[model samples]
Target: MTTMTTDARFREFKMPDVGEGLTEAEILKWYVQPGDTVTDGQVVCEVETAKAAVELPIPYDGVVHELRFPEGTTVDVGQVIISVDVAPGSAPAEAPAEAAAPAAAPAAPAEETAAEPEGRQPVLVGYGVSQSSTKRRARKEAPGVPAQESGAPAGTYYASPAAAAVQAELNGQAPAEPEAPSARPLAKPPVRKLAKDLGVDLATVTPSGPDGIITREDVHAAVAPAPAAAPVSRETTPAAQAPVQAAPVAAGARETRIPVKGVRKATAAAMVGSAFTAPHVTEFVTVDVTRTMKLVEELKSGKDMQGLRVNPLLLIAKALLVAIKRNPDVNAAWDEAAQEIVLKHYVNLGIAAATPRGLIVPNIKDAHDKTLPELASALGELVSTAREGKTTPAAMQGGTVTITNVGVFGVDTGTPILNPGESAILAVGAIKLQPWVHKGKVKPRQVMTLALSFDHRLVDGELGSKVLADIAAVLEQPKRLITWA
Candidate 1:
């Protein structure tokens, strides 16, 4: 039995689980290709997981030997993706005994080795040997039958139906016919979902991906409307009777399709789960924020708030924090599995920021302990990081309550959805100047609308109303912030 062995100078790098328990990541781009030299801690590629986009760095120095997969391919964790030659200038080093043992040892039964090999090492980050025996198996020839149905293993990747048919004829057998209707097509889950959404049949679409797998492009091509046939008129004149052909439709002129993955996909799933799993109740209140608006301008010119992001959001976030302090029950989460309500003592304030990738809520850790200036600084950093798309997954976890500034977009107000695991979300509308009745007289004053959405299971109507009222009260009279604290 022949076994494959690699030179000791060659080292393989496997795709790592970047986030906690993330099983796969899509290779977005590669910075270096084969034959390029690399050093330790150099970013070799960027991958997008369900959480966010992240760059991966190589651990050791070497000359690139090979790249197993191309860009845009989704790779599972613990799969060998790239190899490098560590000792480039030196002669080939001696292969380790264990690396060469498969070739020297007696051949074991096929069932024994296929099921599970003895002494296999556990694959972990930055450690473990690449398994050499897991290469693709050879295809077996069968007369007048497709390779997949002729004892090939389930989920085996095939070249193409045409290639299989040609090979069957060369082997002195009749060419294989088209795959049966009952045969399942090979496509990724996301591609299948896309096809289903567009009402396209995957079986009829041609396969352009490697190993006879259908791709998003192939499905789109199958569903794209054909140019309209020429219209013929029944008339006495010859010119009217003749048919006239229409010009072919240009690609992407009528519609465009975008494949959803990574952050956008995760956000959609989370919003659906949060909306369906928890019973949501929304409360709205319109308040005069003339004092809060004036306070924001004053703080912008004040010495204490200088060089910080001083705006209405700063005070609005502060108001919510103080409100949560008063109504501590609002700062809690429902433990579905435990069937209990876990009340939190500290606040991790979530700020819902809209980014190009999607909407992400990155919260300030332990926001209750922060002073006014410190809170302003944290808000500035969080907004900047999210807009730059550099927010990490850890920055988004453990948020007890959230605030979304829909006011920035000029919207009047909206009933915002709760972020998963959070108890409530506060929406702030545009602060517009309007005529209002104040001091028994009508006058122009700055007014804003606020909407609060909460999970009804943990927060009763009385508790939710109290939290929202406290926020509105603080915004209307700015001095309440100092007194309430």
Candidate 2:
């Protein structure tokens, strides 16, 4: 007979890149109190990175052993979130260990009862992928009932809540029956906002991979679309067609409250710090780049550029890279503590985009080294990922510089804010066919405005102007970009 050794096993659930190829995530909230029994696939916590808010599930059926973080701490990817001691069955109908504790120590003083094992190891933040043994629960349903496929689902199920919610969006689902448990999520403030923006209904989305917890994906699947509502509502009544609806402000109601979460919250804090400390000095210059528009059209048709989006933004990104190469100082930052200008040898170029999750800045690492095609692919991927509200914290972090495409909104220009810890943010305004003096003669041509918001402490008016001029010059004459490179 072979001798067997007894050992405590562990499951380290890493914070996964939930969406937009994230690198890091922030702990938004913890739902499962430590020492509470958690079901396999139960939602133990909620997390928000740059893209979206997700409810992370407990992957094992066990006793809640520990919680590693507080409600609002930021954590890196692959960090442990929670720990489970795993009882043979669901957290023994009652905490047998606690109840049996007094008997084991009848001689001990009652004061020691205060120690009641409250400070056990905690689950980690960012996501509830923690110390566990990934063992599954055995199903409880008759084989004929399809709902019982995964042991006992963390909670009861009815006509899939997500399906019901999406059907509600279609303007004609029977109201939820009084007997049914609400499909609403138990998410915190940040998660609620994320769901709202994605058009996802929290109530119906099924939770998998966690304690019967609904995830952002569950919401997505719920809103996946029954069909588009008509552009004009045919069911409008005379009261509904009033010039404006009154804002309801009844007792026990909330109004005009903004949540500090995800990209919006991060951006707010960063912008505030940058604004107060950096001594911002914004200057603007309008150039008639008729030739730049011509080149944009030319490149769109080029065989070499095949399947690429050869637009003003592409040219602007390329131009910024070129300018940074020429003027390294403008690409650098002010390190007040070191009292030195930190000139980055590499450029992790950030692109500030407006997504369903609010405004996000997802950057391309080593963008200065990427080719045109590579840059194109990166841009496409970033936009698509942001649209899905899946950008991770990793992608949003470590950005040396950034650019914002305000032009897509048909705006002429405005002063942009610098991302915290970074030296500059470039705002690309709309290109319009405005009549202007070409060589001193009024004529119609495509023109755009470029707003470069840089850290005045690092980049002075001279450096900022030169950088803007370089980018504008490239847009004005594409040939200058080749030679400037």
Candidate 3:
């Protein structure tokens, strides 16, 4: 055969239409710089959508060719975010060639265009949803772009604060911890919430974490825990308590005040909106989940799932899915305009994730269809991404039902508010050893509380009660899943 040229077709990474017709998103930061060797599935940048910031993992692995937009620049969805040049003779991501499997495959290029309708608004009072991809986004490419020049610092393109610290730690050249002067301190969001709840001024308390950070432990140590017998008060304000801050170095008087902005400010707005507009009706049921806990332990020790956090939370998520299948109404939404119920065939499961920024509910798409292992992995990724402040707005929408694991914080039970669109939210409370009745005798058993809050307008007391009961019953006897499943 005569000479044949095999020039590789370059692929570009387009900004995916994350869900709602989010016209544009700001490039918060880029994780990789030009010329860095990236593999498929590696996170390259963190983009802030309309709702929250999310880490955009690279779908393809190759040398990054170009960055089209600068940090803090707002880029429309379905635009070219980055590009990777596949070397000639290299196999592409998911390429069907047998020879390409021998070496590192080219990066998995994301779908170039999102075929969403140009401009669609959300049915509710908020944003719209995207139904198509943009074709023009796929062709633009930057040739001879400096992908990565030899051992560049982490996040060279974005230059985020956290990336710097990670670079130091990774290279075994971490700088010496600074001599923390300033006897004063700064409080985090949750600590600030604790201060507001207990009427404690945060300015006075000395911060113990890095950069004089106030922690939840600091707040708890400063005040007493809520009394177990007294019910959790649902009042807007806890009380007018003083924020504790620095005591004087010399014998002196002291006073301080912290503005309730940032987390506290945003949280107040969300809680009020969810609580009032949703008309929450909380119902509780106590169940003995001893078998559920046992099954969890078995799964944890199982050979296949040796490394996952297979805890009670995993089982609770499954129980909620079962309930949704049993009582389909629990997974439905209310259409106020037409005055009708919109029953959904799929479940975009929302797990209320509390983060430093605020509360974000990064949901699972078609959650009802996922297997237990898949659900576990999805939950794991969602929680990890949320805590890192990388959950995207698109991942947080079209949720038909929700599950809030309050027990993760040792909370027994509380009525959760309905997410703006969905009608019902299930709160899986802490599971603890408690005394219970079995075979007409009292015994100590593993117990948990199932709290479900529903919109009274659509979901009546009976339907709500049945859904909650169904989840509780599944947990009470784990074997039922084998039959019901």
Candidate 4:
């Protein structure tokens, strides 16, 4: 048998759907650029989707040949963004110039030479090279002046078409023929839009991109020029000038507008959907959590929970889990398509965390099987990761129940909206000292309010009340966690 070697070819990497059914993602940053050698499973770029920031890893080892899109560009799913040469030693594919050179005469015009097709190979999955001929839009040139000068000044001269035509008529010369459109500076659609919006001419802006392409930074720099001193005016003297009045400020002048793109957009859409689709019934209960607070202090000093997050929220989470075990029917979802109730045997408990980006719920998988210490550790890690904005999309999916602690913000209580696809959500309020009737007498006790919101379709008033009552009962009597759980 004879062994044969294949030629080296370029491989294109497309932007993948990072999140569940995500259609697009913004390129946050690129770790590797062109000519950078990358290995398999090495992260090359970071993209921000509607859910979270995701780091994309290259699938194979190769030398990067081209980067199709720059940073901050929003690319659609399955669009090719990067190309790499897998085999560096092999000869590259034949250039189109060599094939077209013989067909055209040796003295062909520069326009014909510039119009040759770029025969690039299709290397991305589900994408192929377009077979149609590439045509360039004709750029309307000034009628009088030529595109280039034989000997001009050091700096390149650029003028508007109207100005050039006016100057040519004054010089008493006929307008020169237009040049090829390919001679114009190269730029992406977004960059051209930015230049137009900033009132900056692309012809006067020097390009800093690869292959003489114009970039956003180049356009911005052209718009912001160095300050020059204004000439002193002798016509209007300071003594003869009249007093000027200050104009009134408009409304919302100091307000800043932030674009809704990533996690914030997803959160807004989910809240609107949940509020309209589900019949939300919220019930409030003011409970005495003096025992629960004392238990939190004891656990903080315990050897098992020393380094973990030991707080009222930790005990409250355990209490809710215990309550779920008592009332398993509450841990379910209503399937509209199937017209049935989907009850989950396991619990993926979600904790609503407020980060700099927005509110995100990262859940602890299999919370029903973990002990108190394990639960505390998981909560600690979840809070830490959420604060750093490193929570993955998988951590935010498939949650059966969620807990939003408004107490941290000093809020008394709130009717929290249910997370999408979840059956119930619990809100914990600020714990304060208040006089309550205990043992037939009014005494000072640590009291806190709990709000439970549920879908009325799946959980009736009785079942929802039972779950909330069970949670309050466990918090009031801390020993029930051991007996009920």
Q: TM-score: which is higher, 2 or 3? A: 2
Query: Taking the tens digit of each residue's C-alpha lDDT, what string does model 1 give over 1-485?
Result: 21223554456677766655577888989999989988766888888878766677775666888888899988987677777765455444244423433354565456533632454333323333223333223232233433332222211112134334544465667876746423556654445645775678888998997556676568758875322111221111111111233446677688545677878799999999999999999999999999999999999899977667678888999999999989999999999999999999889899887765667787876789888887887777676666555666656777899998888767889999999999999999998999999999999999999999999999999999999999999999989899998
- Per-model TM-score, in order, reads 0.69, 0.57, 0.53, 0.65
Each model's total of backbone clashes = 0, 32, 35, 4
lDDT for model 2, please: 0.60
Model 1 alpha-carbon miss at residue 111, Å? 20
Q: Please say which candidate is ahead in lDDT: 1 or 3.
A: 1
Clashing pairs in 4: 143-175, 143-176, 144-175, 144-176
Better of 3 and 4 by TM-score: 4
- Model 3 residue 22 distance off true place after TM-score fit, in angstroms: 5.4
TM-score of candidate 2 versus the correct structure, residues matched by position: 0.57
Instruction: Residues 166-258, candidate 2: write the lDDT tens digits.
Output: 223344454343234332444323344346655667665655524344544455456642222112212211111112224556798766554
User: Candidate 2, residue 381: CA error in Å?
Assistant: 0.9
- lDDT: which is higher, 1 or 2? 1
Candidate 1 error regions (>4 Å)? 1-5, 93-96, 99-252
lDDT of each: 0.71, 0.60, 0.61, 0.70
Range of the 10 consecutive residues with the lowest summed lDDT in candidate 2: 233-242
**Leading candidate by lDDT:** 1
- Model 4, 110-158: lDDT tens digits are 5533432553322211222221222222222223333332111111111
Which stretches of model 3 miss by more than 4 angstroms? 1-50, 55-271
What lDDT score is found at residue 416 in candidate 4? 95
